[model samples]
Every structure is written in C-alpha cells, then in structure tokens.
Target: MSNADSSTKKFASQADLEAKKTSFIKLSDNAYAYTAEGDPNSGVIIGDDSVMVIDTTATPLMAKDLIRNIRSVTDKPIKYVVLSHYHAVRVLGASAYFDEGAQQVIASRGTYEMIVERGAQDMQSEIERFPRLFSGVESVPGLTWPTMVFEKEMTIFMGKLEVRLTHIGMGHTKGDTIAWIPSQKICFSGDLVEYEAAAYTGDAQLEEWPATLEALRAMQAEKLVPGRGPALLTPAQVNQGLDYTKDFVTTLLQSAKESVAAGMTLKQAMAHTRKVMDPKFGHVFIYEHCLPFDVTRAVDEAQGIKHPRIWTAARDQEMWHGLQAG
Candidate 1:
C-alpha cells in the first residue's frame, strides 16, 4: 500500500496506544534489564555499595516503575544514571534517580555534544512522534545533561566488580555507550543491538553501524540486555541478538545504495526496501514505524550525507508528508 493510503499509512512518529507489558529480568547476579515489549529498554547494574541505571525511561513520572523494580531487590543507592545514548526517550528521565542517591549522570563526549547541538529539537520531535511514550513529558525538568563524560572507555568498581562503560564506535548514534561487567561476562548494549524489534535509524550512522556491531560481538558476552525485546540470558541468545541487528542495518543500507545507484526517488526507494525487507521483517515490532526513517537515512548516507541531518518537529512533518505525496 502507498503511504498516502489513509487506512494503512502509518506516520513516522505516530502513536501506538497499547501499553506494552514490561519485563524485569535478572541477567546476572548484579545486572538486570527492564524492557517493555518493543519500546526502549533500561539497564541496571547493582554495585557493591551502590547501583547504576543505564537509561531512564522518558520522564520522572515514568521512571518510578523502574525505580520500584530496583528497590524491590536491593536498597542500594542509585549512584549513576548512564545514557546509552542521548535520545529523548532514553535520557530525559534522569532526574528521577537523583533522589535515589544518584551522584553522576554519565554519557560519552559524543552524546553530550549531541545534546548541546540538537537535544532541544529532538525533545519536541520525539514527544510529538511517540506521544504515549512521553505521556509524562510534563514531569521532565529539561534536557538531561551528563555530569561525567568519557572519551573511549571508563571502568567503575562496585566493591570488587569491574563494570566498564565504553564507546566502541558509532552505530545507533554517534555517542552510543555500552556497559560491560567482566566478572559476569554481561554486556548491556544500548540501542546497538535489537533482537526482535527494528532498530531506530533516524539519528544513526548507517555506514559505520556494522563494524560497531562487530566490536560488540567481540565482547563475547555470556549474557546481554539489548535495547529492546526480552533480555538475552545466554551466549547463544547474545550472538542471535547481534546477528539480528547487523542483518537489519546492513540490509537497509545495501537497499539504499542499490536504489541510489539506479537513481530511484525516495518514495521509490521506500518501495524497493519494502520488497526486500517486508517478507523478512514486516511482522517485527515498530518495523512500520521505523522503515521510512530508516530508508530516508540510508538513502542520505548512500548519497554522501555522512552526518545525519538533525531532526526537528517541523522537519519530521515535512519528511513524512514528502514521502506520502510521492
């Protein structure tokens, strides 16, 4: 069906009103994953004397649920709030952890710079796109700024547990960060790896994504908590999650490159992508929601746009309608 079809047309950032059932899974002795169906995920690392929250939900009000889960098992103070990346849905709820004894809000230097560059625009853009995810948006004080920013990788000790947070390379976003616990052989890969859900590529670096995924694979994580989907509790599952993400991104970019080589318009490229990906990924969560943006970004990269263009609410509509019109 054409994007103009009223009945089947799904807007880029439209609403999915159904509340996703959340899963709070223990990946290891110290690590846990909070995932909602196919919505974004947050990771928890309980250290010796304190705890760390990987990504906050959307707003302070929404983060209460995750905090409750953390409180159930351990009463340790929430010492660090790590932004897997600077996306609004992932980082905006950081304020909620301060009362839990949070001392530092952590992110990569790349992520911090992105917040400075487009955090405001992305805030409006995301709230408008995924309205339900941000129903508690009013509770957000403002953009979440990281207090501790790292360049390559930094290690934290939870008593004797060695937890390392690293920025291997850019995949989902330029500043994507991952948490690794060496003792447990567990990795909390932010949005870099998705198991059953489509990876959001609106702000992604398409060309470099695969190599970044490979870097994650080299970790040999025995357990992994991906950005979405259920928590992976085994090495086999970890490899599966990695492969699924790599396949999706590589296929999307290749389709875009082929379309560009043949001089296909954006709309035509969308059609081409659907023909190849639909049979494989059509039924996955948010595939419809993410495909257009994925194709748009992939096409841009193929045409030599290295840095992803900043997305604003106004630009969101323009691009949505632009795709629909043709």
Candidate 2:
C-alpha cells in the first residue's frame, strides 16, 4: 500500500471520527464513565469532595470534548488524572485536565520509567504511524509527565467511596493497571481488556498477559468501560469481551509457536498468524496496525526472548513491509 493509503488505513480521519458525548451512567452514586463514540475513553469519578479522571484522550484539543462532558455533571474540581499506561494516545491530553485544577497525575512506576526511557521515540513512531489520531501534533509539548507513581497498588477514598488501583503485572505493558470501584463492581480497564478493537501488543508481556486478564476476571465487574468499544453492561458481555481479548493473545502465541517448531522465519510466522486471526477479528479498529507488531513480539517471546525490543520508526516500516507482502 502507498503511504497515503497506509495513513488512511491506520488513522481515522477527523471528519469521520465523531465524538458523541454520552450522558454519564452512574456505576454507583459517585462513579461514572464519560465515553465518547469510542474515539478514546476517559473516566470520571465524583469523590467525596473531588473528581478523578482516568485516561485523557490523544490530544488536548480532543480532550476538550471530555472536559465539556465533565461540565455537564457535578462541578467538583478534577483532583486526580490517572493513567492506565504510558502510551501517548492515552496520556498526551493530560495537561488539559491539569488546567481544570487536577491536583496530581498518577501512573505506575514502570510507566514513569518508560516516559523517561522511550517516550520520545514512541511519540515519533505513533505520530508517523497514525496522523489523524494526533490531529494537533504540533501542540503536544512532550510526553505527559506523571506527578505521582506507585509500585503495586494504591487505595484512595472520596469520602465514603472506595477506589482501588492495582498494577496487575506486565500484561499490555510493564505498568498496566485497571481502576476498580468495589462498591459497584465496575472497572475502568485500560488496554488490558479490549472489547472489539485489536489489543496493541507491540509493548506487551505476552506470557504474563493472560494471567493478568484472569486476575481482572476475578474482579467480577458488573459494568466495564474497556480500552475500546462500548461500555459492557451485562456480565455476559463482559465475559465475551475478556474471552475475545484472550483469544487474540492465544491465537497469536500459538501460531508463532507452531511456526518456530517448523523452522519458519519471523516474517513467515507473522503471515501464518494473520491468516489465522483475520477470519476471527478482521473488522476491529487498528487490526492491521497491531497484528504485524503483535506477531513479531509473540515470535520473539516464543523463541525465549524475554523483553520486547524498542520500536523505532525504521523498525515499524520494516515490519509493515514484511507483513503486507503476505
């Protein structure tokens, strides 16, 4: 595909991407999810005297929609902005929240380290890969900095409401987390649980991802706002979303394993996995953008490679070529 077609394939056009601000659904009396038309999800929790936001959108301009939605509800000052991981698409709009008087921006220790180590590289790579998502690219100052960092788990109370944030291991990334509201059995599952969209595993810990999902399942969330797709209301829909994500991970790893057993190259292994996964999950958002990277990482992991290597712009183009040929 030409670069123009490639760009269109990956990024949703600004005109095509409609941000539908939904009325806040009360997970409990204090917690709510301010979801758009699946552009990028942000969470809202009205604490005892403050409000906490989960995951700012891709750009500050895009985040204004979230801010507008927040205005519709209580006027509590946004006290905290919690990042589920370190991806720019999720955290770049953080400054917008801070402008509204957010007290501290929180992220896991691993995510904090990632911003220090590979943030610039990731910013360049993702911008070149998906232009439309980063509509106001020139406006982003740099990686969003996390003011507060945690090791494993942290608990905070908004008056009587209890909110638990836990780092559930290296699933989607080294510092993946899910915000749990115990009183309502609701979870703001970041990229750890994709409803219909393809889980981007470029920076994932494959062996540990399944166990992390299992841990999330044990939470028994009645309502969940996943990393992508609509809010899962029923228990059955939640289970289906979890199972679908698991299936994607399982299929990629198993295909890579079979290819390794047959002495196939990484390119060959990726082709095999795509052939297998497309029939099952071809229509999800960013499926093409994610699959090649997912297979490459899975193959490396299957061959006993522990850590995922950093992806530069050069590496992305090289992998895209290899996958497209198949």
- Candidate 1: list runs displaced more than 4 Å: 1-3, 6-13
The local lDDT score (0 to 100) that residue 311 gets in candidate 1 is: 91
Report the C-alpha displacement of residue 226, candidate 2, in angstroms. 0.6
Deviation of model 2 at 305, angstroms:
2.0
Q: How accurate is candidate 2 locally (lDDT)?
A: 0.80
Model 1 C-alpha lDDT per residue in residues 68-171, reported as the tens digit of each score: 99999999999999999999999889899998899999999999999999999999988988888886788999999999999989999888888999999999
Pairs that clash in candidate 2: 48-158
Clashing residue pairs found in predicted model 1: none
RMSD of each: 1.6, 2.9
**Tens-digit per-residue lDDT, 1-326, candidate 2:** 33234434332222344334544565667767765544456678888888888898888887787788777877888888999998888888888887888889899898898888888888888777766677676767778998889999999887788888889778889999788889888889888888778888888888888888898888888888888777788788889888988998888888988999899987778767878899998887667667777888888888998877888878887776665453
Which candidate ranks first by lDDT, i.e. highest? 1
TM-score per candidate: 0.97, 0.91
